[model samples]
Target: MLEDLAFPIERLGQAVTDVQLLFEKYKYENGIIFGHAKDGNLHFVISQGFFTKEDIDRFEHFNQDLFDLVLNKYDGALKAEHSTGRAVSAFVEKEWGPAAYRVMKRLKNVIDPANLLNPGIIITEDKQAHVHDLKVMPVVEEEVDKCIECGYCEQSCPSRDLTLTPRRRIVIRRAIKRMEDTGDRAGRKALLKDYRYDGMETGAVDGMCGELPGEH
Candidate 1:
């Protein structure tokens, strides 16, 4: 759970009949599902690669299909959590119905006419908002590959004040990996030399990352 928060997460929560309700259709390969199973609310992480229009369009389609399955078909909530953000804001009206959404828009206009606070937050008026400004994940190692680079993990890190942060560690590792892949031995060696202290040594809060699921 902490690991998911530590990384850049692109996906949203889906509360289903069960997690298997999700598996019954699509094979969520690059993601993992875990949450309060006993209470029927489950959270999963799926790394999205939104590099192109077709890519964003694919995700947009998935989001709509998911909304249809959850909200239209199964009669589930679009957001198990409170705030929807842009990812699910497009569906807010669909979830709450037209009249309720109007009330929400009216309330927002009344309170924040100029829209000073959080421009594209909860209730977005954009028709194709979800298709725009999508976050794309780069090709990294499988260990940190699934990370969306969201930096949620920095807050609870024990070594945050000691040296580098969890996010910083991953970022440096990415550079070092890039150098290695590009055959720049000198650059890679230099990065590893500094990383040996800042990211490698000082970043480990008594082997917190080693506690990942299924790790020995």
Candidate 2:
């Protein structure tokens, strides 16, 4: 929670504690700490001051200590909703424990035998995989390719007047395309869950996008 990080930081300035204790108490401050309270996992943004090798080492130790407090003490996760991607993949085992991690490895091996799909994510060789160099490709070729260069959807978008457009639809199309290309059924299912149907409905005929039965 956002308060969890900030409350501690504010307390530290007033509380009588050594620099080490202060460092230990508020290390999560160096990283962005926010997450869905309903889910119980926090997201973090480590300072870019951690760009150097020495800084990275220090941050890693600091993060390990913070995880020991936040995760082990509180029984929370290092990652809840987000995938064990490039950033937090190395911490999966630390969070999940060896038995659970082995099960995950087995599942990954069964599902992605070749490991060509997002390898080093969620599973990796060294335990110190840092979040770096993650790239995603477009997926929905049919919808994206059907643009016709007219920008009709943009013009017709209900939110366009409010300075917003259906950008998520484009993202969905790309996700669908990736699933089709990589055969990632789980990802496809997750992507499709975000879709909502809009337009008029009539008995035995839905007026979706102004289409009525056989009308062209």
Weakest lDDT window of 10 consecutive positions for candidate 1: 1-10
Model 1 lDDT per residue over 1-216, tens place: 111111112222333333345444444455577655444455666655566776666666666666676666556665664446777777789888999999998999999999998887777878677777754344555776655566887887778887777777777666766666678789877766776677656656644233222112
Candidate 2 off by > 4 Å: 1-32, 131-216
Candidate 1 deviant stretches above 4 angstroms: 1-28, 140-143, 149-152, 159-164, 168-216
RMSD of 1: 8.2
Q: Which tens-of-lDDT digit does each residue in 1-216 have in candidate 2?
A: 111221133333332133235364545455343544343433444433444666566656765665565455455555555445565677778877899999999998999899988888779876666634423434334434333222456766665554324443554555566686789888766655543332222111212223211123
Which residue pairs in model 2 clash with each other?
A: 32-45, 86-131, 87-131, 139-177, 139-178, 140-177
User: Cα lDDT of model 2 overall?
Assistant: 0.51
lDDT agreement of model 1 with the native = 0.61
